[model samples]
Target: MDLCLFVTHNCPLGCSYCYSTPKMDVNMTLETAKKSVDFALSHSHDEFQLSFFGGEPLLMWDLMQKATAYAREKCSEKSIPPVFTVTTNGVLLDEEKCKWLKDQEFHIAVSIDGNDRMHDCCRTYPDGSSSHDDSVRGAKIVQAYYEKFELVSVVTPENVNYLYEGVEYLIKEGFTDITLNPDFYSEWNEAQLDNWTEQFKLIGNLYIDCFRNNSPVRISFIDSKIITHLKNGYEQCDKCRFGLDEMAVAPSGNIYPCERLVGNDTGEHIIGDIYNGFDVQRMVEIKNGNGFASNEECLECELAPRCMNWCHCVNIALTGDMNTTDGIVCFHEKMTIEIADYVGGVLFSEKNPAFMARFYGLR
Candidate 1:
């Protein structure tokens, strides 16, 4: 099981496309944190991950420490090793914090859009000052302490042209695990979409070249798709055990299906709370409700079997209707599958047998 603790709804940066409403000023109390941890621990059997999430989880540093300590104690008693992780914008990271994070064995994911100009375009301070330098500095500190960490960059229409540049910058910065995610909910015009497709193909070629030469590179978007293609001809939504295997806890102790569904106001999405436990029936309804029965486009498409439709949260965000699929998101999904199939076929057949070993880290 994976339990995400939304430590707080407070953030220092004012990224233009931020999904969380950081102005709400909601912080998870220690009492609520303890209860949420206890609830998750009790339900977990062998191993479980405790992910610290938020508008900026580091803002509630004190609460995070307490919760982690409590979780560690409980897990020790239960004889289960605890796995911890945090996803942050990298503004508040310091040497001390980096040391503590490394000591705790927390898998950190830092948000950096790309180069200075591209990153500073939207990731700015509340006063509209540039956050590029500070963010890079923080990332460097974390990297110095922890050899492995994920660099997560969001790609919007405005920055679509910089896709290759952004990834190149992360590679130069010594990051091996990188993820460039397109903002599916953002309005993408023809020009932006065209640019994104071209850049994506260029990046795919670069990945193949790197693999052939045995260079360290792992782009999550492309790599995940390739892995899915190799294992199963396509991906399926039911394989995503969100409400069952993973859950997100809000500041008020309310439990949600996932992190994306945390701040959403819809009452139907709230499966259960720490005080009451999971609503198994509601969870089943959510999982069963995510198939192609509702989306006519998916039902008729050739990729339906291998497709994982826009997640319910993304669907609601883009269309204001959870049951509906967004045209733009669907377009990106189809393109991704097509590209993954092509890339996987080329690498599997033409490349050296060691290519898969190197790509998958068995080498």
Candidate 2:
């Protein structure tokens, strides 16, 4: 299900790390929006999702209203309604916008790091001051308006040191759900993994704290990992939602599985033109692991089944092969697995009291 009818490419803030390669350089038009919704319903996807992302989504706020209404009407015609999600920088979110999102019951993800210093380093405006203050304000309004919204912090080396502080701040801000991602807008290298470990370790501790405090906020990383550990699946993802062959439509009506994959840096993955119709069979092939991608070092990892080689975007960035079999991952599955094992021994089996003493690999 192409849950993303990627609305536009034009954004107000010029973030240095923005990774946008438009299928066509255009703004969202009402007719194109209608056609996109029609395309989704045509597939009879049953339950559909429409997510608004952008250079900055609010830049096209008026267009979004029209598209949202049209999507609803299209779904009605197909005897199915659409669920909406928006990922925004929060520069433009205000009282009225929040009311509309709440009224529509859209799932929203706001972008912000812990404090001003961290937030500005990765996300900024043309003048390059920092969007931290405004983003925080917008996040507040959005959270009040949309109960299910979340905050996504783009992790950078500079901000990596502050992961604990950011987590504490987000929890205190009343946002229970958060996504802390490595800042991919920059180049990938070995140096970044150390930062990721620090962040993940903090997150693991946060889960322990959550358990102790009876926190209702869902920590995606640890909670999902726990679920996967219990179910014999992925550490965070139960099933590869992207593996299901989801698509992202650009402003000009071109379709691809995800925005990250749609970058001009690699355009062969763009399946079809939305103006016509998506190649359903082609899409199925890609979704089912039949698509062409180069798998690099991942070809040797033992954790392939669980991690599925991590994400395609991350793999390409790290190893230059979007299709690496077990290409390195963000959370460091090896580390997480070790942590999970240690957690089991310490928290479950007092039979292994020497756990901390055993970061050393046993003979």
Alpha carbon lDDT of residue 72, candidate 2? Answer: 84
Task: State candidate 2's TM-score.
Answer: 0.82
Question: What Cα-based lDDT does every candidate model obtain?
Answer: 0.80, 0.66
lDDT, candidate 1, 1-363, per-residue tens = 789998887899888878675556888999998898889988899987999998999999998888999999989999999999999999899999999989899999999998876787677898889888888898999889987889899888877777888777778788778888678867888998899888788878777776676674888767767766656634453355567778899888889878877863345468999998888788777767754425777768876555556466777667766657778877777777777677777777865455667555553
Q: What TM-score against the true fold does each predicted structure earn?
A: 0.90, 0.82
Q: How far does residue 54 in candidate 1 sit from its true spot (Å)?
A: 0.7
Candidate 1 residue pairs that clash? 235-306
Query: What lDDT would candidate 1 get against the real structure?
Result: 0.80
Q: Could you tell me which residue pairs clash in candidate 2?
A: 11-55, 295-324, 298-326, 298-327
lDDT winner: 1
The parts of candidate 1 lying over 4 Å away from their true place are 234-238, 264-268, 279-281, 290-293, 320-324, 349-354, 359-363
